[model samples]
Target: MASPPVILLLVSLLFCIATQRLYAEQAPNYTFVKEASEVSPLQGRFDYIIVGGGTAGCPLAATLSSRYRVLVLERGGVPYGNSNITRLENFPRTIADDRPDSPAQRFVSTDGVISSRARVLGGSSCLNAGFYSRASPEYVAHLGWNGTLVNESYPWVEAVVANVPIVQQWQSGVRNGLLEVGILPYNGQTFDHIVGTKVGGSIFDAEGNRHTAADLLEYANPDNITVLLHANVHRVLFRTRGRNQPLAYGVAYTDNTGSTHRAYLERNTRQSEIILCAGALGTPQLMMLSGIGPAEHLRSFNISVLVDNPGVGAGMADNPMNAIFVPSPTPVETDLIQVVGITPFGSFIEAASGLSGYAGATSNSDDFEPYLGIMSPQIGQLATYPPGERTQERIAEAVAQLKVAVAANNPAALGGGFILEKVFGPLSNGNLRLLTTNVSDNPAVTFNYFADPADLQACVQGIQTIEQVINSGSFTDFRYPQTSTAFLLNLTSSLPINYIPKHTNDSTSLEQFCRDTVTTIWHYHGGSQVGRVVSPTYHVLGVDALRIIDGSTWNFSPGTNPQATVMMLGRYMGVEILREREQS
Candidate 1:
């Protein structure tokens, strides 16, 4: 089952040498990478074409590159060197940014929840808390995937990016708090999504740096992979044979310059494929945009129906998050999610501290919103000092030294953390529909969280469970404004902690709290369910030479965060495709 040690070592060295060759094209730096503007019309087609260079796209492209020429078209720019993406502390700043070039693109779901999606090369992985957990064995069996292959696929991704986080004080307290609430046996430091409370992996490293899906490109044979940035794919081109289903042959996309370019599969090879690794939102929207959704919906947009599959934009699910802000009198360490409690009630409990990196006490001050700009306000504050404290030259020196945000850790410096519960197995689901012909515009979607009575009861259970944890001995000391007999519970707003909904009143129940405070944990899935929109093997139904391999194709969102499984699916599909080709 294994190759000899010497042979394995030799193969590894050869791969290293090949990688060097790719990055070595410094004179034409990023020879394998180019802005869509720099790339001319394709003189040659590729063996495989991947759309969306985010979380799944990059890995899928890399795995295919080992044996086939692959092309990746990404709408957003590269993620390298972008501080908002590379630095752990800038996560809040990154997500808050809504500028045209911002890596995180903001979109409000029809559910009235504001959320953001990944718009950079690494996709949402660059913007998320970087929590990495594999889907449970149950999830794999439910999807009917090859269990062995799924396990094999994850290790490669983890080796590339996952890290054992240095669980700091705040996260430790949260872990203890979870145990106090009786979430059950603590499974320490594992990446598996099991039935107990556990500390999982993250993409953020010990040095507080991030490694995104883009990093997985190192596994590719660079000579066989071409990546184009700022390439927004508009539609998939199809060719129909007489009395046969239509086949995908190519894609048309636009560059930043507004010029359109087309890339196609290699001529005369039925093996060639055009895969959609775009996330849930993008994948389904693209199908509809390319005329593969419900006939009535496509007809409304003047798009000719190719497949008329109503399932393309149906069954949208988002894990609803109910969270509370916990303030600490004593300083707590800055951190993102580390420990998670997998409750038997179909909820996952987690926490994050020190976001926004404020160096003062946490407050309800309206002025706190200014930190949303993050660096600018602090940099401006750096300029104001007593005459003796800093002369103009001294200010300049201080400013230069502080430019890298060396002090931005421990948002708990403001003295708090966020304890959040995300509902798993949410019964409520919704749909996605086109708003405009523009591919860049967000298609309207509604997750309809808590639409089902069971879902609301689950959220209420999670809230009541958190109340017990807060009242527990392990976390009681962390509650700030200790002046009260207990908590400063407002008549209108009570339970858990501070800054709750103003609409909550004396008679408000935990169910009311669940509805009033619901937000997104960003693990969106469905819209293209297996056995509806695609084959179990990921091929798009009613079409040939096309596949959809992202969270969009999932029947349910798996694990605490879906990034790990999304990245794994990319690798799993690539290996399966290659294996099938070899066998053929």
Candidate 2:
């Protein structure tokens, strides 16, 4: 029944997916990459030593490798061919996995919200929902970036690690629902960080395979890049000059075998450097460890101070998020944040559906053999370690249940999805500090969600917008109601915010909803700002030949998702570094 043009498009897409999968499997073999243990001396000199081979680090290393000998030291293993990260449907499990070797590192902030950061070579780009939107024009100008160079850098990142997503059944419905709520006139599809409803780009390909920043390493001259995995950098080595600021010379890192190794920039290499792309949390933590932070704080850890600066881990901020879960009438296709509703009140609405079970194989007493329980016709439950549950049996039961539910046209029987809102430009801020001298341990951070009254007001507005979308005609088919009226998601407040009349006695209830349900979108930034801790060129202040390039540099998050700008930043700076050297 389909038209020829539509059918031909589908065929072409399928072919493209198949080709990408084959290309991934047949990726280039780089003889330069090795486990830290494989390298004998474990000490060398390079033109640049970049710590943390993450979303930004990989691209920066690849670009710099074209002109200089570059070394990238990643504390985690590779993400290639990892099913947990590659498959779009396995997102929940990937975020919930908490093992020591897992690519996702789970941590709870002092503010009491659960979050995760990437420990894989591709960095958080490997762990995120794969959304790709550039920084707003306002943000680019605010940072004093070269507008021409910034524009030129984006396509390079997109060509290797991004794609135009195929908007499907669930996403299409959400997009309509967003428009119905009066979020704006639809902007159709775009990768720009604009104001309106739009289908954003993704790092995931048509085949449900994730192409991470690690894939950008293909652009590197393999002969010039020496990447070492399982390399945990401890501190930056510095050489002090008489009555002058110290100069960073190298780094000391521990390998998988608990043996330490030192890698450095040659003493005579002109304008050589050490770069930290260890992310917001890791970069500031490393600076403090290297005795470059608050004098009293570094003294507490028995680290002798080289340069005292209290700004190392100040101004920590994360966008607070709230959500509602709605079950659908039919199976929704697997997707993550394909459509977004950019609100006028500094909030962004997004959704993801069909995430699988959340069970991680951790060596804890709580590890359980989970089973699906049909508690009632309308409800399903997860069992914790029910005697001896087999993986095959669990799969069989799930498939059988799904088939029956679909045949019966039972909306309540199907798995539900989530609609979430995250407030932008959060005024609230917190700080990050070390618990011990161990650089390997997760540091203590507190992102004071909704600490500012202004942020709470924005959250109230965003939630009200979501209420309109839920009550809209476009979303009616997605919900199964028990009554002719309506039912609201209970977010564990005094009552669901929508249940009360809009002209209620007090607006205090809506503010209460913001505090009680505060969560994270994991878009945290600003431990090291450009003006405070680093120069406009990302060079660390008061330290020679050291630079920091990552999400930590920004006081304001670039876009709804920060990965696109972060990746672009790396490439932009890399080109600048090469151009400076060439001109000189």
Candidate 3:
């Protein structure tokens, strides 16, 4: 009925709409300098060189690139299109992958605590559980940071990667359980730190796609920033002028092809700086390698001490966790740390449901039996005995039963596991020391978990609190009826021998249990404490043109998950660096 011209216009509009939809659905094509050869004849100078293009490094580089030539050297590959890094459902598999170059780099501490650190461009933010929360106001003030500036800076990173979590059924149950146990009136969905049950922000979006810190680079001035992946910085290169303190002028790094490359600061500008955002483990390790650790420790390795900052790799702390795995008879939708219970006792009890089960194992040889046993403190005690001894008998029995359950594809046994993690705040002590002069070798990491009696007591109390939540009326229907692995085939089984808490109310048994089962929540901090290794302004003490702006500089771990604090610190540092540059 329309005129010929009108008909043509209608067809054109349809074509445009379809084209736009197609474009919107298409994945982003990221251009990365993955090979050393790609940066042929690497530039001799950059205004700022950020080591470790990680959670902090990415945002810092993005901010600095607005006015300066910034270089970000990441030891790992890019996360673009990597399923393990982008998909929420792939959480466990990603961290469990043992490949040296995988996004997750698994390492065991000297105390037998097993964990992993991120190796990808986004670092641990890309591999972590994706929970996000702001640092407690008290914690922010403790650092003597400009509280006003910090509050202003949080939104810059939050706008890019943070999201209000989508609460599913399991998370809802957790919320109700916490309230029933008197965690207090619900704080609801919020990003601020409060003492109550609340749903905080997550890096994973509503569709279950993960948005990592690397995504913040979209705000960067690409023309001024060059991000090079697989660029492993071995040490900071320093220049000493007329007996002045050693000034960081450049860095020596290895590329993807194992070729050594050097990138230096422009001699013309005193504003040029080498910033270490390489995280708690990497930053201190790099400093020590550059002759900036305890004088005696460096001397023992025959490495010249650059600064003799004894605090460079001291006073490390990690949030130790004790978890309870609850299985379900029905399939539950996958979820993560959506609802958190902040207790008045300085402990955090969080519950997550719907992780993939044993049936999803990538290999037949994959042994999940160790994971089940490892989550308990009893396993650590069993390790002291020889393989066939009585101490090992209970575990062996539990493992056999678990294997049988897995083989039978029991809905109650195969899938639908919920984890209740009790993350304690700032009370434990640990340290990282160089094992070898070689940068590739992992440092000797020792988390003397629960070494302090107070920490042990807190963990024991935390476990008791978690049990209270689990036993609450809200979780009655969702709770797994089976308790004994030995008779798991029996539909009405009580508590599995493996699932039993070593001692329900006995402090000694609980303390022993904590020793065996406690592992890091991965909230590591203070390897280079503020005012110890670095000034409160975040510059390294007794050094020139060097700053640390990552978890390493935190005086103590925040009272909650530290990703939000890490990002906030990155933004705060970026602003400080900018201010300093303007003054210079």
| Best-matching candidate per TM-score | 2
Clashing pairs in 2: 369-385
RMSD in Å for all candidates: 9.6, 6.8, 7.4
User: Where does candidate 1 clash, by residue pair?
Assistant: 354-411, 354-412, 412-415
Error of 3 at 344 (Å): 1.0
Q: What C-alpha lDDT, on a 0 to 100 scale, does residue 575 get in candidate 1?
A: 95
**Candidate 3, residue 8: how far the Cα is off, in Å:** 27
Model 1 over residues 136-173: C-alpha lDDT tens digits?
99999998889999999999999999999998777787
In Å, residue 466's CA in model 3 sits off its true spot by: 1.0
Clashing pairs in 3: 291-306, 377-516, 377-517, 483-494, 483-495, 483-496, 484-495, 484-496
Task: For candidate 3, write residues 366-416 as lDDT tens digits.
Answer: 544422222221222212322224233554565455556656775555444
Look at candidate 1 and tell me the lDDT of residue 539: 92
Give the Cα error of residue 543 in candidate 1, in Å: 1.2
Candidate 2: regions farther than 4 A off:
1-28, 42-44, 355-413, 481-487, 491-508
In order of appearance, the predictions have TM-scores of: 0.85, 0.85, 0.84
Please write out the lDDT profile of model 2 over residues 115-177, one tens digit for every residue.
Answer: 677888889988888899999888999999999999999999999988999998778878899
